[model samples]
Target: MNETSNNTVIDERSDILETLAKHRHFLRFTTRDLTDEQAGQRTTASELCLGGLIKHVTSTERNWADFIQRGPAAMGDFKNMTEADFAKRADDFRMLPGDTLAGVLAAYEEVAAATDKLVADLPDLNASHPLPEAPWFEPGARWSARRVLLHIIAETAQHSGHADIIRESLDGAKSMG
Candidate 1:
C-alpha cells in the first residue's frame, strides 16, 4: 500500500501493512454469513466471541499505535489501575449492547487504516519509548515504533487464531482447512 504524505509517496511500509491486512482478513473471514447474535455468542468456554475478538483487536491496535506516537502516556498507568479499570478493560472482550458485527468490523478497519497511515508517515520507526509500568513488561524497558508494530501484528495474529476457534465452535465453518 503506497500512502501519500505531504505529496510524497511512501511504500516502505507496504510489507508491514500487507502482512497486517492478511491477518485481519482471516479474522474477519470467520464472521462471514454470521448474524449479530451469532457474532456475539460465546462459542467456547473461553468467553470469546467473534465480534468481541474483533473489538478487542481493534482496541489493542489503536492503543499500541497511540503508544508508538505518544509514548507510555498513551496507555495510562496500568500499575495504578483500580478494579473498575480492570473491569472496563474486560469490556473489550464483550459484545456490549448495540454492538453489531458490522460495527465491530468497521471499527477495526478504521483503526487498521489509521495504524497503516501512521506507519507510512512516521519519521522514524527506530524511535523508542519507555514502556508503561505494567507487570508484563520489564522495568525500564523501552520499545521502538517498529517493535510496537510487531507487537500489534503479533496481537492481531494471535487473536485471529482465537477467533478461528470460536467461529469453528459456533458453526462448522473453518477459517483454514
Candidate 2:
C-alpha cells in the first residue's frame, strides 16, 4: 500500500479501537462497587440484569472477534441443540452459580485485548466470511471484519444503555454522575 493508504489504515484501526475503549470504560463503570447478587438483580421489567448484560456483551464480542480470525463457523454448531440446551445458552446472560462480577470484568478485558490486537494485525478491514445461519440473520450473508467491529461497538453501546437503566434502578446511582 502507498503511504497515504497505510496512514488511512492506521487511522481507521485507531479510531475503532479508541471508540471501543471509551464504550468499555463506561460499561465497566456502571458495574462498580456491586456484589454478585446485586449485579444479577433485574431492576427493570425486562429479564436483563447488569451482570447478565456484562456476560452477554463479553460472549458476543469474543465470538465475533473469533469469527474475524477463524471464520464464521468458529461460532460453533448450534443447528440441533435441544430445547433444554437452548435454555442453558439463554442463561449465559445471567450471573449463574460460580459467576462473579470481577470474573466477568476480567474476562471482558482479556477479550478486548485480543480483539484489538486482531484488528490491528489484519491486512485489510475488507476481510470477510460467510455468516453463520441464524433465525434472525438473513441467509447467505457475509460480514467483513469492519462490519464485525461495528457490530461489536453497536452491541456494546446498546447494552451499556440497558446497564445504565439497570444500575440506576438498583441503587439510584447514575452511571456517569
Candidate 3:
C-alpha cells in the first residue's frame, strides 16, 4: 500500500514536517489580505514588517538547508563579513520599493516544499555538521540534521510571534484562528 493509502502507519516525517507546516501556515496567515505597502508597514517601534519577515524566513531556511548539504563551509567566512556585507544581509528582512507580499510568500512556499522533500529523503537525522564561527554561537558547536530541523522550527515560531504583533499593530488583525 502507498504511504498515503496506509494512513494508520504514521510516517517518519509526520512530527517535524507536520509541525513546521502548521507554523508556516500561521506565519503566512498573518499576511493575508494585505496590500504590498501594508505588508511593508512597521506599526511598532521595532523595525520588523510582515513582508520583510517573510523574506527573512525564506532566505534563512534556504541557506540552512544548503548548509545541511554543504556543511559549515557553505556559511562562508561569517567571522570576516564586512559592514557592507552585514548591511546587505540585514536588508533582506525589509520589503524594498519593488518587493511584494505575493513574491515573498511565493518564495517562502518554495523553500517549504524543498525542505519537506529534504526531510523525507534524509536517511539519518543524526548526520552532523560543524557550526560556523560566530560570537553569537558557542565555540566548536556541531549540529545534527535533527538539531538543525528543530532550530528551523524554533526560528519560524519566534518570527511568527513577531509577525502576529506587527500585523495586529498595523490593522488590528489577529493571527490566532
lDDT of each: 0.89, 0.89, 0.88
Score every model by TM-score: 0.92, 0.93, 0.92
**Between candidates 1 and 3, which one is better according to lDDT?**
1
Q: RMSDs, each prediction? A: 3.5, 1.7, 3.4
> On residues 1-177, what C-alpha lDDT tens digit does candidate 1 reach at each position?
223453332454676788899999999999999999999999788988898899999999999999999999999998789999999888899899999999999999999999989997888777899999999999999999888998999999999999999988988899999
Candidate 1 residue spans exceeding 4 A from truth: 1-12
lDDT of 3 by residue, 71-99 (tens): 99877788899999999888877999888
Off by over 4 Å in 2: 2-5
lDDT string, candidate 2, 1-177, tens digits: 642368788898999999999898889989999999999899989998888898999989999999998896787766666899788778877988899999999999999999999888888799899988777678999999999999999999989988999999999988776
lDDT of 3 at 71: 96
Q: Looking at model 2, which ten-residue stretch has the lowest summed lDDT?
A: 1-10
* Ranking according to lDDT, highest score first: 1, 2, 3
Best by lDDT: 1
Error of 2 at 20 (Å): 0.5
